[model samples]
Target chain A: MSGDLTARSGGLTLPRIGDRALWSFVGRRIGHAVLVLFCVATVSFFLVRISGDPVRQMLPPDATAAQETALRAQLGLDQPLLGQYVSYMTGLLHLDLGQSLFFHRPAFDVIAERLPATVTLAAGALVVVLVVAIPAGVVSALRRGTATDTTVMAAVLVGQSAPAFFVGILLILVFAVNLQMLPASGMGGIENLVLPAVTLGLYSIAMVARLLRSSLVDVLGEDYIRTARAKGLTGWRIVTAHGLRNASLPVVTVVGLEIGNLLGGAILTEQVFAWPGVGRLTVEAVTYRDYPLMQATVMFLATVFVVVNLLVDLSYAALDPRVRLS
Target chain B: MPVLEVNDLHAEFRLDTGTVRAVNGVSFSVEPGQTLAVVGESGSGKTATALSILRLHPTPPCVYTGGEIVAGGRDLLTLPEREMRQVRGNEIAMIFQDPMTSLNPVKTVGAQIVESLRRHRSLPRGEARARAVEALREVGIAHPEARAGQYPHQLSGGMRQRVMIAMALACRPKLLIADEPTTALDVTVQAQIMELMADLQDRFGMAIVLITHDLGVVAQVADKVLVMYAGRPVEAAGADDLFERPRMPYTRALLESMPRPDVPGGAVLDPIRGAPPNLLDLPSGCAFHPRCGFARPECASTVPALEEKAPGHAAACVLTDDDLPGTSEGRRVSGT
Candidate 1:
């Protein structure tokens, strides 16, 4: 026991993550993400087919029976359901999301064209949420029980409880209709991105802020915080240096979940703002019964969400040293 | 002149239901290089008094009703907050009871020490870090460089306490307030930590205010002992004097209650009667009167002042020295 004690305390250095161990951890997480994506593709491919016959929706109501049969055969929709699923999976291996019926182009190409817009909106909203929420949270926590804290918290509650479509409409009414300071819809300059991003990001902002406030409040009560104060650290230093990092653990989890929500599709926000993103594109595909495009979009979202959650886990390990990656 | 003087300090916690008076009119002084142990049971206001000196208690709930904490020729209560920041770690440092929770879990122990150094000293990062390693070495932690890079969870309880001591003493403050510094460690480790504190006090020549509930800890290193009961000091005297010639009934009861191995095999230990009084609704007159075996009619009607029973010893009780039992007289005691 004494020898064990000496060994444990003998060389007290920062915990080192070996290159091999780190790679193994990353590899394992990546493998799990891939498995999740595959499952998503399988489920979505089978589920979309069950909705109805796509050939009937693809053609007009007055089209001839021969025309309908020819269309189904050409698109390979006439095959058995099991055969079609296997073929879809096989095509996915080659990264070919079969052609879009509406655009008469590969589904992947069509979706990729609009991917940049969704990415931009999601990234912009993320930036807005982080910039606004962190300071608000820290201040609310510091001035807890005061009028300032109550007002900020009330604002956050409104932001969280309000539906995305309602918030989008409100922003459009105030910024576009009343002031005419910005465009109401479409992808253009930074101004056009503002309303949609804020509408989609408001709930995320509220979530991050609430989580950060509660976490910081708990951290402030810790003995280490008192130690920091006793060490003559100013209030700002104590909050930023000693308090924020510890509080960030829970906030990071909330932020990661919000990112998944944004990337998967801010469907309602896109509709209200008329933003040209994958969310709007997915709605269009579902309306026309574009099975391949819908499947590809759902698969793409599932992959992004899985990868993002994996990164969140890695960050958790980084933020808290005691949490080791297995 | 005394290094730290606390005069008639009163601290209370205001809740929705009522106000709980934790420390009532407590007063004492510690000269340079002396160790004054404030001994009491749980919730007896010893810890409250220590936090009061540093003004670390939360304000709305924890209010200092009345008092003055004078140190380094200035009244701490009157000092502006900005200047008070300078005095906190520069002139008066503190180490808490549990070393486990007293450190930032996410930060390196070295970073914490360097934080204190750079906060008060204006030293660059590199210099502060070097000094941090040196501070760790001063506390007898082996592999100081390696230890400095580690987090608090990586170190043992004893080592963590040493780290706390190092952090407290890094600025060479004129006074150090240690609140139950060894309460969380094993007996053997406790002895080592206490010895380390004594050694550090000798080298730094900083007065220490040690707050503890354990009489054994007080006897080991305290030059002066202040016994508190129900949020007020009931007795104050030199360690040897208080141990051998306890005058207050409560103090005598406390001494008698301590389990001794050297007593004859069949001797039954006499535990003190009654629990400590509730601070929210304390009994009338003396707080300890209801528990005192020697309580008289007057003891319940009026509180007794802390009168000097010896040249330096004082106790707050209605009983005269001649009226108390003689069992504790002429007995020599030393803490293990």
Candidate 2:
């Protein structure tokens, strides 16, 4: 008989999907997601209604009343509010948001067209956040109160304090303008993606680093850390194997929350870089009073937000045993 | 030779507000297969001394000012951290006060044991897992294979501690320092854990440095007992000797406070009069003098050195058996 307690197993073993408990849990979450989406759809529909006449806004000021009337009648805006709501809800049943005023294609189609670029930017930015933030945070926590920790914290502060648009502009000036290493603005190839992704990710990287460092600092003080040390594990091993799992609970929460924000079209960065992503489409849709496109973008973002948060909850249960999915 | 020898150990915490000398000149030794219980109040530095041997204190604030923790023919106090890592869990292992929070919640109990086994042994992954399961079974956890996969929260507190013991003993270190190991458990579970440790000791024959504030625990398993007061060893003797003839005033007070059936019917469970002395600014001489019932002016002025009043028994108080006429001394000390 040995003293080895073999106290815990690391990765989660997924219970069979055929299991009734897991299926019910997923079913309940989907139900909640649907409820949330319905509420969001209802709100965005009405909120869009108040943003002034989409038909009138689309027409030129000098256009005749007959022209305005023709546009309204064609777009079905001449119908009563309740009739409009009923038709809109009916359209939703067929999975149709009306045609984009500007794009002249189905509104969902227009938003979906711009989605890949937005997803690319968001994905690149997320990679940047993880690659830069986690290591810096780990180092800062391990070297706490030393110059290394102080420096990382100070740099994180600068990243957090800097405005996204401002950081974007600075990156453009350095890499695209003066250095002439990449394009200053406008989307083209992977090179153009770099500056914008970095600029967009800067703030989140700082946020994650600061959060991870502090979370880890607290975890390091726990009795388990001493237990790990007494087990004769190296400091680095303990941090990675033991401390990180517990410390990362909050970090996972912050990053999960950040993913939703990033995916919802980084407007300022899109505008600065002229990236032609959904964020830019969102702006054009709003400025041109493209109601269908506007409704589509908001719904899409809301869906992404809801789904991502649900995944985050599931991930929490996966990482921590105490948080049960049921 | 003793399995572990600590000589003139001094450890202090350098907080923002002045230095607090937590363990002051504590000296002791434990023979192989023997148990030396270091009993003390909260601030009495019993925990610090145990932690110091492992160099487990967080370095900046917790500095071992001067000491020698001799083990495996080297002074552990001065060993490089890399070498110290080898000595820890291999030569000497330690279990902490809280079992509930001591094990990582995310990892399964089996994995924690596997980690400890792999740290010192160059076993294959499958072999380490087998060893871990075997260790859990040794600790009396039923269905050890299934229990190894469970998390700490899945087990009872008594079960968690048994897991802790399994992990600490997996490497079979020469000494195990159990710092208040049973304080967080229920009375029945506490007895079970203590008995488990004794049973393990009988099998492996490792020395135990039991740090506790419970006299009851000390009496149960300790072969030799060292009672600490104000961060210093106030009394040291065999458990039987110290229980019968506690030479120091503080040790006398500790035994009196015990609720034993052997005591007279009306004996007062006299609590020590004052709180333990502040380690930051310990009083002029003998740290416990302020609270001693028979404090002479000399007890306040001159710090008393621990000296043997009888063979194999020593205490640090100024008075001898001669100072108190009727106090030989258990009968009068127990009156509340």
Candidate 3:
């Protein structure tokens, strides 16, 4: 039995696909991501232009035609549409997003300053999602048809149907006003982070938990799980070491898309919670017709969406050898 | 003493429709170093009987109505889940039909083997890893070190079954319940796996409860044979004796169904005309009577007991002892 124990044909060939092959896959994905981002930037520029002129919206109500004209020229809103498109595209090439009309700073700078806040909000919401979803999904799958599973399913249903903004207000009314436990609004320490994170993550948490529960439940019934049991693995090991990794594939895919969904929906959530984030800034820029800031926000979110999906695909390859084969 | 003794094992599925008595009063045993083949068609409770030994049946749906699966001096039926865990991989290991679906797709074959070894033996991590590779080699998998590092999809069907055998036998359990282990492989690969299993049994002195419908497999490896029909054993005897003189009509039909070289070129293969009776609502008497060619009026009203018609040879049919084929009238086995 111990004879012919030598490794086959030289160096490591075990990882399904090698580093160069994986990197090449990533390179192709990056190429696709650039194309998607470029399309979003172009579409946003035209789409935002059709929302009406920022100059007209910013002018005084009783102002004369000449005053409106002067403001338009000063803001470069008077330039021809294609000329404006050229300048915007040129600015993007140099990593410059034009001046924010209201902030009177570079549009990139305005969005960048708020990036940390949005990042923290997204990170906290994700942490909340995983913390809540993992145990809920796993327990529900393991204890299927039990009261605990039914209760979790019911709770997840309520969470799925409740809008983020509505959830945020209800949380504010209960936790902040009634209990006097947490701050009602604005950003600060750990205390301020909890409600907004929960509110923003509510729908995603529901989605992830539901998907995970179903996925895990399906995986637990697989032939290998019975094999695991026959091997004397009980309780946690069978569920975790044998089951969860396979179950997480669908959840991982959903999470990537949900994070993109989370950011888009963060606009309403930030409005309800009064938490300053790029989402809130994007709303502000839209209200005042700040085109550059609007374009910048679109670019930021589009970039985030693209990068997240790329990571998810890469993770799919890493998690399942079947995926790597294709 | 026998390594595994299953007595009057009864198991049922409690579904919305009704209770399904999958295994009803099925009894068999296997001495150490022996192989007992449970032969039956699909849904004949062969798989259920095999699963009952390890208490691996799905519980919400499956309830062990009655049984004693004795292994290593303990009734596995009454043992708590915690103690059952020790008995499972440590005393009796099992392998399934499809090697493709029987492994964790996300895990390497070696890691899966290492997991069971560590679980049962509490081997140190490095030692477990080394044994895992050796186990792969023992199963006749070429380049064991390289194959160990590869995932299930990376290996062929035969290679994966070898890996499964390695995993099941790594701890050298007293009994191994192989449920149609060769059913999913190529014809040539099937022979190779069967040979590998027989060789391993010789080396380890492990008993086997091999559940299969293929009579060819039973004829090749079984020391003893038990034929089941609708969850009840209809015949039990030494393998050679059962083939030579199958007293039960169902067993006779099963034997006749096999394609043999001895049969002439123009001779057609016999197929038992009807389906096996449903477990949920089995026919009143002998479950196979509806399908039996020689079935009589009494066969429908009376369930024949599996009594020993000869020393160590039992059959459930009500045919008289003197009803030999050449001397018989209409009740002969070859009448079909």
Candidate number with greatest TM-score: 2
What tens digits encode model 1's per-residue C-alpha lDDT throughout B1-336? 999999999989999989999989899999999999998778889999999898889898998899899998998987888998999988999999999999988877888888899889989877888898899999999988888878788899999999999999999999999999999999899999999999999999999999997777887898999999888989999988899888888878877777656655313568788898878888999888888888888888898888898899999987777898675753445563
Q: What digit string (tens of lDDT, one per residue) describes model 3 on residues B1-336?
A: 989888999999999999998888988889999999999999998998999899999897999999798888889999999999998878999999999999988787878888888998899877888999899989998788878777788889999999999999999999999999999999989989999999999998999999999888888899999999888999999987787788898888887776665445313577898887778899988899899888999999999999999999999989965663642122122211
**Model 2 CAPRI rating:** medium
- Shift of residue A273 alpha carbon in model 1, Å: 1.9
CAPRI quality of model 1: acceptable
Indicate the worst ten consecutive residues by lDDT in candidate 2 chain B: B327-336
lDDT of 2 at A185: 77
What ordering of candidates by DockQ runs from best to worst?
Answer: 2, 3, 1
Better of 2 and 3 by DockQ: 2
**Which runs in model 1 stand beyond 4 Å of their true positions?**
A1-18, B265-268, B329-332
For residues B1-336, what per-residue lDDT tens digits would candidate 2 score against the true structure?
999999999999999888888888888999999999999889999998899999999988998989798988899999999999998898999999899899998888899888999999978878989998899999999989888888888899999999999999999999999999999999889989999999999999999999998887887898999888878888889988887788888888777666665556535576889888777889988998888888999987898888898899988988978884443344422211
lDDT at B315, model 3: 92
lDDT of 3 by residue, A116-178 (tens): 778888888988888988889988998889999999988977887998888999999999999
The residue-by-residue lDDT of candidate 2 on A1-326, one tens digit each, is 22223333566644446767667888899999989888888899889889878887888889999999999998888889889888887888788988888888999888888888899999989999999999999999999999999999899889878988899999889888899999987777889899988988888998899999999999999999999999999988999988898999989988998998888849889999998888888899899888888888888889899889988877777788776667
The model with the greater TM-score, 2 or 3, is: 2
Q: Name the runs in model 3 displaced over 4 angstroms.
A: A1-18, B324-336
